[model samples]
Target: MEITNLETLPGKQIIAHFGLVSGSTVRAKHFGKDFLAGLKNIVGGELKSYTDLLNEARDEAINRMLNQAKSKGANAVINVRFSTSSVAQGASEIYCYGTAVKVS
Candidate 1:
């Protein structure tokens, strides 16, 4: 399925809109990784562990959202959006959402 963050895709007309679809994944930081992150915090550098984890979560959520659209016979997903939240002290959730639609 094609996914776009824009309201519409260029060179194509939306023939029908299905409905809102969403997917989410939650991850927790490992204690070992947390200690490394804490050390990195002192130097104010990128937290590679969290970065990789979040990227994976984002992709997983998007994949699930796309699967949902496919199950509904949608050819594309429009106005895609991603969000992140901390559900617990060490856990974070990544969500992907969009409007399922048919396009030509």
Candidate 2:
């Protein structure tokens, strides 16, 4: 399915709109990675482990959002957006949302 962050899909007509759809996932930091991250913090550098974890979580959330859109008979999703929140001391929730639409 096609997806875009703009208000509308460029060069495509939105024939039908399916209102709002969302997907979310909660992820916790791995113990080993957390330990490594603590060490990295002491040295002052990028925490690649945390970065990789977040990226993977985001992708999973997006895939779930796309699946929702597809289930709704939508060929695309518009004005896509992502948000994150700390759900627990060691975990965070990744959220993805968009307007599902049929486009041509």
Candidate 3:
């Protein structure tokens, strides 16, 4: 399904609004990755491990949100937004939300 951060899709018209749909997941850094990230911190470089982990989490959250929208018979999701917060010392929660809409 098409997803956008804009309130409405450019060329599509919203035919129905299905309120809100959301998905969230919490992920923790792997021990091995954490150890490597610590070493990288000393060199003051990008932490590729953590970056990959977060990217994966974001994709998972988006996929879940899309699934929910699809279940509601939505063809697209508008006003999509993402949020991230620390759930614990080494864990973080990723959330995605949007308005499910049937567009034509």
Candidate 4:
């Protein structure tokens, strides 16, 4: 499925609105990574662990959102957005949402 953060696709027209579709995942910090991250913080540089975690979360969320759009017979998803929130002391929720639409 095509997904864009814009309200509309560049060349396609929205033929039908399939309503909202969303996907979410909650991820917790790995114990080993947390320890490494603390050490990295002391060194004052990029935290690769957190970066990888968020990247994975984003991809998972997108995959789920696309699956939902496909299930709804949507050719595309417009106005796509991502949100994150703390679900627990070490876990975070990643959500992907968009308006599913049939396009031509």
Output the number of the lDDT-best candidate. Answer: 3
Error of 2 at 31 (Å): 0.8
Sort the candidates on lDDT, descending order. 3, 2, 1, 4
Q: After superposing candidate 1 on the true structure, give the runs of residues whose Cα lies further than 4 Å from its correct spot.
A: none
**lDDT score of residue 28 within candidate 1:** 89
Candidate 3 structure quality by residue, lDDT tens digits, 1-104: 99999999999889999999999999999798898888888898788888888999999999999999999999999999999999899898999999999999
Error of 4 at 87 (Å): 1.5
> What tens-digit string does per-residue lDDT give for candidate 1 at 1-104?
78899999778999999999999999988899999998999999789999998988899999899999999999999999888999998789999899999998
RMSD of 1: 1.1
Q: Pick the candidate with the highest TM-score.
A: 3
What's each prediction's TM-score?
0.93, 0.96, 0.97, 0.94
> What's the residue-level lDDT of 101 in candidate 4?
97
Q: Model 2 over residues 1-104: C-alpha lDDT tens digits?
A: 99899999999998999999888999988799899888998899788988888998999999999999999999999999999999998798999999999998
Report lDDT per candidate.
0.92, 0.92, 0.93, 0.91
Residue lDDT tens for model 4, 1-104 = 78899999989989999999999999888799999988888789898888889899899999899999999999999999889999888688999999999998
lDDT preference between candidates 1 and 4, better one: 1
The local lDDT score (0 to 100) that residue 102 gets in candidate 4 is 96
Candidate 4 — what's its lDDT?
0.91
